[model samples]
Target: MAKTLKSAAVFLLFFILILLTNYETNNMVVEAALCKKRSATYPWASCVPLVNDNSCETHCKNKEAAVSGFCDTIELRQGFIDITTCYCQFNC
Candidate 1:
């Protein structure tokens, strides 16, 4: 009876571990997809174009002029702000 209980406990522990691992992997995949979608929708300039540029501070200050020169002409305003914010945070 003791041996049987030990075996059952081990099995239960293994099963729970597998379940947790699977849940974690699925969550990672979902998060990656959401990140990709967000990046594609927003692009950097809309949120923080100067991220890669040498003059980030100036670009951020002149957002209206900068956006007008770049994104406004392109007309990709859907998730532009969100994308920019995410990009800036990620870079920072």
Candidate 2:
């Protein structure tokens, strides 16, 4: 019966270790998802002809504590004019 008890203890320890590791990973994912979102208008003086993802990312990188960005178009002046802007995904 001692052998069975030892095996059971080992299994329990292994299970606890796996649970602890999963908990830590979940906490990291939750922390990453806690970032605040923000956006800014690109080419502030005028509108661009096309959406440039690289430039939009660079523009967001210029902001303080910006993580990453993408390009999107937004309407202005009662939805008449569509302007491209850089949307920053996260600020941590």
Candidate 3:
């Protein structure tokens, strides 16, 4: 019984760790996308809407511009993973 309990506890801990890791990864992906999108549209004097805002559909009409901007940003291209780690540390 004690061995079974220990095994169950270990399994539970690993399961929680996996869940948290997955959540963090998903958040990083979303953040990267948003940063790319914002960088793209914020130039050219356009008003970019927040992700949850209803205007996002209209705001993202120029996705190519945003993607191009994302590609050009050295931080996004070279240090994206580190940036995501820092962001996660602060936000999550």
- Per residue, candidate 3 scores C-alpha lDDT tens digits across 1-92 of 99999999999999999999999999999997765444322332222234224232234434332212211122446645322110111111
> How high is the CA lDDT of each candidate model?
0.49, 0.66, 0.44
Candidate 2 colliding pairs:
none
Query: Better model by TM-score, 2 or 3?
Result: 3
Off by over 4 Å in 2: 36-92
- Superposed Cα deviation of residue 8, candidate 3 (Å): 0.5
**How many residue pairs clash per model?**
1, 0, 1
- Model 1: worst 10 consecutive residues (lDDT sum): 83-92
Residue 45's lDDT within candidate 1 is: 47
lDDT of 2 at 88: 67
Q: Tell me the lDDT of model 1 at 77.
A: 73
Estimated TM-score for each candidate: 0.45, 0.43, 0.43
Inter-residue clash pairs, candidate 1:
47-84
Candidate 1 lDDT score relative to the true structure = 0.49
- Residue 37 of candidate 3: its Cα lDDT? 40
